[model samples]
Target: MNDLVCLLFQSHVKMITPMLLKLFIFASVYQECHGEERVDQPDPHIAEFEGRSVTLQCKYKTTSPQPELFWYIQKENHFPKYMLKRNKYGGEDNDAQFQERFDSNVSSDSVPLTIKNLHVSDSAVYYCVLQPTVTGNTRTLH
Candidate 1:
């Protein structure tokens, strides 16, 4: 009886071990192959405006397990504004700029930045940035 039990246990472990190893390797490869996505790859169209408000849109490509959405604004020869509104994990941080003249909605798949009460200063080009949960490159717009 003891010998039989020992043989059965050893067979079970051997069978499970290879499966576990394969699963681990597959998960690792999937992670490695899919990295942070490029939100503004090949550069999106530069929106031109002569109106009170402007909406800048970006099309992104990502296979991220988790994604965070953001919108940034930068005037000619000016630094960028890191504004966060929504994320994939459901965290919302309204930036000062957004608090003032911006209203937005975000999701794991898409981010839309709407600027209202636009002034001449706001005439500059805007960007839609997507920050994924995974540690990788940051995607930006112009």
Candidate 2:
């Protein structure tokens, strides 16, 4: 009777061991797939025009909370310069430059830039920016 009981216990352990290992492996693969997605994920879209409004979409992912949104401009071979600060919901703060040439707003997830009177000189690169709080990372448009 003791021999039969021992045999049954051993078989149960053998059956459970593989299932536990498979569960662990499945969890690891799931984590790996999701992890790769979070690294430097790209935004949905960006648009530009010579004499019309432009909208730049920004997206980000982090381990912690979401951060502020911003707009910036950059010159050739120069560091980025701040243009406007954005509310979390995408409203522009109306900086002097932004108020002069552009009307802007946010709709919870996007920054749409409207150039009231587009000009040839307004053809420089513009960006919609996002800062993710937990990662302390910044994303920009070109």
In model 2, which runs have C-alpha deviations exceeding 4 angstroms? 1-51, 57-66, 89-91, 133-142
lDDT of 2 by residue, 1-142 (tens): 1111000001122323465557545544754776521222143333344445544444434343445566655444444457776655444576676678766565444555556545555544455555555454466522
List TM-score per model, in order. 0.55, 0.47
lDDT by residue for model 1 over 1-142, one digit each (tens)?
1111000001122323465557545544654676546564233443333344545555555666666666655555554457655765667788765687676665545666666655555544455655556556567522
Candidate 2 has what TM-score? 0.47
Q: Which ten residues in a row have the lowest lDDT in candidate 1?
A: 1-10
Per-model CA lDDT versus the true structure: 0.52, 0.47
Scored by lDDT, the top model is 1
Q: After superposition, how far is residue 16 of candidate 2 from its true place, in Å?
A: 56
Error of 1 at 71 (Å): 1.5
In TM-score terms, candidate 1 sits at 0.55
